[model samples]
Target: MSQALARLPGLGPRSARRAVLYLMKKRENALRPLLSALQTVAEKLSTCSICGNVDTSDPCSICTDPRRDEKSLCVVEEVSDLWALDRSRLFPGRYHVLGGRLSALDGVRPEDLTIDQLVRRVSAGGIDEVVLAMNATLEGQTTAHYVAERLEGFPIRLSQLAHGLPVGGELDYLDEGTLAQALRARRPIA
Candidate 1:
């Protein structure tokens, strides 16, 4: 169990062992529900066809919802970023998940992302704005710039999330509220 849990993102061997021990102590309550929830998520979760967001439904609840602003789109590097933005409750627009950034070292390219689909959505869906909510890392900025270049002369306003500090990335680690503030203070990328 320790080895299995150690494979997770943040859990080291020691943390995994501690977590496993805790789970063992709460086997009937926490452990069972956790196992069941993991199984359910693994079985049910799928990529949304429109935006690449993970959902039980193909189009995703956000894409289908009439309350969401169809004219504005937020482009993000991953579904995790989308969730972070959604948690802020500041955006009313829809989203496009790129899955990952362009990394020549890793052989990740523009074609590998959902850029073509995003362009199609912008052109065909009457989109007015595209907020680039990608990470603030070097690769993230490169990817965002590439997207902006591709969407040039498309009659859409392109913007990017602010830079300075990040809440999630370990700049010695940060708090969620600080991240939210950074997002809110985001400026357009020239």
Candidate 2:
């Protein structure tokens, strides 16, 4: 059990063992409730067809929200980044979750992500800007550049999250305040 739990991200053997003990002590209250919640999530959670957000809704609440800015779209490398931006409540625009960045070292390519779908969305019109909010890594930047090149012929403006984010910084790990600041200070990528 410890080994299985340790296989999860951010959980090591020692931590898994501790968690198991704690769960055992509170099996009825904590452990059972957690199990039920996880089961429910597993059964009902789905990826949003429009924005790639994982939720109970097919389009997700953000995608279908009447108040969201349809003219602006924020591009991110993962669903976690989308959630991070949502937590900040600083962006009123829609989102396009790329799923992952271009990583030649890892054999990740543009086609492996939803880049083409993004192109179609931009080409279809009504979008005014697309914000590249990927991580500050070489691979992330490479992905952003590829996307920019793909979208160059379109009339939509392109921008990136501010340099306020440290090099190699990931959106999911940052606080809401920092994310809000970054979004507020975003500049055109050119």
Pick the TM-score winner: 2
Scored against the true structure, residue 25 in model 1 reaches a CA lDDT of 99
lDDT of 1 by residue, 58-91 (tens): 8899999999999999999999999999998789
Give the per-residue lDDT digits (tens) of candidate 2, residues 124-148. 9999999999887688888988999
Whole-model lDDT values for every prediction: 0.90, 0.90
Residue 185 lDDT in model 1? 74
Distance from true position, residue 162, model 1, in Å?
Answer: 3.7
TM-score (C-alpha) between model 1 and the true structure? 0.80
For every candidate structure, what is the RMSD over all alpha carbons to the true structure, in angstroms? 5.9, 6.5
Predict model 2's lDDT versus the native.
0.90
Candidate 1 residues lying further than 4 Å off, grouped into runs, are: 164-190
Pairs in clash, predicted candidate 1 = 162-186
* Candidate 2: residue pairs that collide: none
